[model samples]
Target: MLTRIVTGLALIVLSGLYWLQADAIPQSPMSGSVGADGLPKLLALVLCGLSLIFVVQSILVRQPLAAPGIPEDDQDEDDAAFTRRGHVLAGALLAISIVYSVILPYAGYTVAMGFLLLAVGVFYHRRMSAGIATFAILGAVVFHLIFITLLGVRMPEGIWPNVLAFLHAHTA
Candidate 1:
């Protein structure tokens, strides 16, 4: 509970900082009514709200009645395994994030995002399939349309422009 509260407080501070940074973004004439800062500000608010809820939920939840009696002997082993798994998963996710950032500029948003989704999905599901591939492709396309086409953000073109040029030439 103390940890949860502390984490929530830290998140609140982080969200405040994020909101300030978002507020600092310069206004552009090309921006929509919501402006470029809209999304970041909204995200910061959402994070703060979620953190508050987390802190409250942690405080309200009662401790597990001392397991109703004597604890099982495997408890320590189970905790150790759980902690180890958590660390491994955290490390794996961090590695994925780093790779995504490194590749984003060269791969373009669509391709890099697809790779991120596929990699994360495979990591969690522990398997790969046609379904995952389709999801990744479709997800990337949808996100590309939302952020680039609709929002008009100037994301990296990377290898996609060349591919698109070749395809258009062949088709034409």
Candidate 2:
């Protein structure tokens, strides 16, 4: 709980700094409705809100604070279990991330990110479900729109470009 609160507070500070820097962005006459700093400021605000929520949620959970540098014999069951599980959980996340990076060029950003999200969801929930699948797909689509459509970044195409062209031609 303390760790969560501290992390949240740190994030809140980081977001505030981000917002201040974003505010320095100059407005352009040709800028659209959102403007140059719009997305950055919005992201900072969202980060601040999330950080506040994290701090509040951590406080609400109210876990007993564990003392640091406790002797191995004095360590509690919860701490031991968490320590034991941390390696496995971190390993799973790292392995999945490696796989994502390896397959990204072949799978494309959208598909690879969707797979990553799905894998993370499964890791956290310990099961596969329709809701996780939907979230992964929707999240991937939103990311694709933000990076590819709005920002006009050139990502590894794999099959996406061909697929998009086919859809566009058919729709037209």
Candidate 3:
């Protein structure tokens, strides 16, 4: 019941923000038939619909909810544990992303992505050697192909750009 209520409230807030952003979206040459805001608006509408359904179901099922199987004291402990783990993972990911953004301008796509992937894998407790090797190789290859080769999108070229360029030239 509490979960449902909280989820519904979050959905409501997100939907409102999406709607407002959609409304404020300016016209652009790149605007396709649906435009920049279409997908977000559609997603927000779906979330709102789901939230309404959940609210209605919660209201209809008027059963007094017991504290989930755990004892009340244990439940608080479990919740805290869960929250701490979530925060740790979230913070790690956020830090990696921020570093990627900052370094991309200097390091170029391949190196920056390699570092980001390695950081994320290590942060998640993957075996260090395997994680670093796998993510570094995979991230560099995949993102280089997608953004640089296929999409023709420009990526940052910092100190590491020459290294990436050399690799690409030889490999290609």
Candidate 4:
């Protein structure tokens, strides 16, 4: 299938990039045994290997490569069930990701993620009260668990951090 071909090509490109960058990475201060580029290089090598396997499998199987499934020019009644608004919502979600990336460092992960969640809920026609409540709790917990706890990445301390500090001071 065309997907396999694209995946193979992408893997090849990624492997090349990793191989090229492996030599340029500086030594990591936290882990002196491994360089900064070590993880990427390993990932690239794995991707290359997997891609090669896929390519060979496709060839051996003799399966004809086909492009992604595109619907015929005639719009079916089932297709009409999906509204333009659905597409708009999808586009909005994508835009929110782009905006979140830009705002994350300055606004902090919690705030940016909170706003993104609320925006998505609103786009999908959820009520404001329910959306805000869900967004606040879910966004904060998920982002914290993923980026802070699991990934061991430090997120910026924006307004929410100050609010937490204030609460702690008051409680103590």
Candidate 5:
């Protein structure tokens, strides 16, 4: 319940800030159907609604916070251990994100994102294998297809100019 309240409150505050930032975006001279702020504003509104729902659900829930198989004393210890593990995992992911941001410009989106995905997969599962690399590369390609080809968004070309150029030419 406490977790729900904290998460919901944080989401609400963040969503409000995002909405304001989106609203601050200037209109384009040659505007199409949706303006620059359209998707961000809509996403913020959705986030706000979800946050309110979380808050309300937290308030309404009345179940006892006890594990069926564990004693109360052990349960507390388990919770503490779980919390510590969660904090460590969060820190690791944050570090990965910082590293990813620093290297993204140098490596380009496809390679950087593939590395990020593979790192995350390995971190969570505590294993690295050929499948991870295959999935990571596939994920990056799908992201490129959707974001670049379908959405017409520009991605960093970096070291793989010929690869991107070939893909763009064939797709176009």
Candidate 6:
């Protein structure tokens, strides 16, 4: 709840900054359509709305400040198990992310993104492994299409330079 409120307040502040910056954008005298500031204004408004929602939700939820779910009974074994499990999970995730960052250039965006997404999905929902893999791969593909193909962002090709070459050729 603290996290929610903090993030909401931060976003609200950022949205105000965005609004100020957007208003400073020069309007085109010739163009009759929406000016350069239109998109930024819309984005600022959306951010403000979402942040307000989060702040309201956090306030209404009233999350406890203390360490929640700590048993008062003789449950040392349970607590130890929980702590060990959390430590192991967090350590493993940290290690995986470090490796992901290191090998991202060598593996290329598609493979790296797919692996990252799949790892996260599997970590969260091990029972739906196949669905998670499919979703991750699909998401990676869509991200690649939007950033690499449409936006013309240059991602490292690594082992699959031909893929980017093909995309560039087709776009040309």
Each prediction's number of clashing residue pairs: 0, 0, 1, 0, 0, 0
Per-residue CA lDDT of model 3 for 80-147, tens digit only, reads 54577788877878988999999988877788888887877787676688757786889888999999
lDDT of 5 by residue, 89-156 (tens): 88999999998888887788888888899999888879998888899999989988898899998878
- In Å, residue 136's CA in model 6 sits off its true spot by 1.5
lDDT of 4 by residue, 56-161 (tens): 7756756543557855334577665467876776686899788878887767877777877777667566667775768766977798899988999988866667
Q: Pick the candidate with the highest lDDT.
A: 2
TM-score of 2: 0.47
For residue 36, model 5's alpha carbon misses the true position, in angstroms, by 26
Between prediction 3 and prediction 5, which has the larger lDDT? Answer: 5
Each prediction's whole-model lDDT (CA):
0.89, 0.90, 0.79, 0.76, 0.86, 0.85
Model 2 Cα lDDT, one tens digit per residue, 1-172: 6878999999999999999999999999888999999999999999999999989988886854456954433356767546657878778889999999999998899999999999999999899999999999999999999999999998877777888899999999
Task: In model 2, state the lDDT of residue 98.
Answer: 99
User: What is the model-wide C-alpha lDDT for candidate 5?
Assistant: 0.86
Model 4 C-alpha lDDT versus the unseen true structure = 0.76
Q: Considering lDDT, where higher is better, how would the candidates rank from best to worst?
A: 2, 1, 5, 6, 3, 4
> Model 4 Cα displacement at 113 (Å)?
7.6
Predicted candidate 6 versus true structure: per-residue lDDT over 43-155, tens digit per residue: 99999999999899889968444466754323366565457778898888897798779878999887898888888788778555778989998999998999899999998
- Candidate 2 contains a number of clashing pairs equal to 0
- Work out the TM-score per prediction: 0.49, 0.47, 0.47, 0.43, 0.47, 0.43
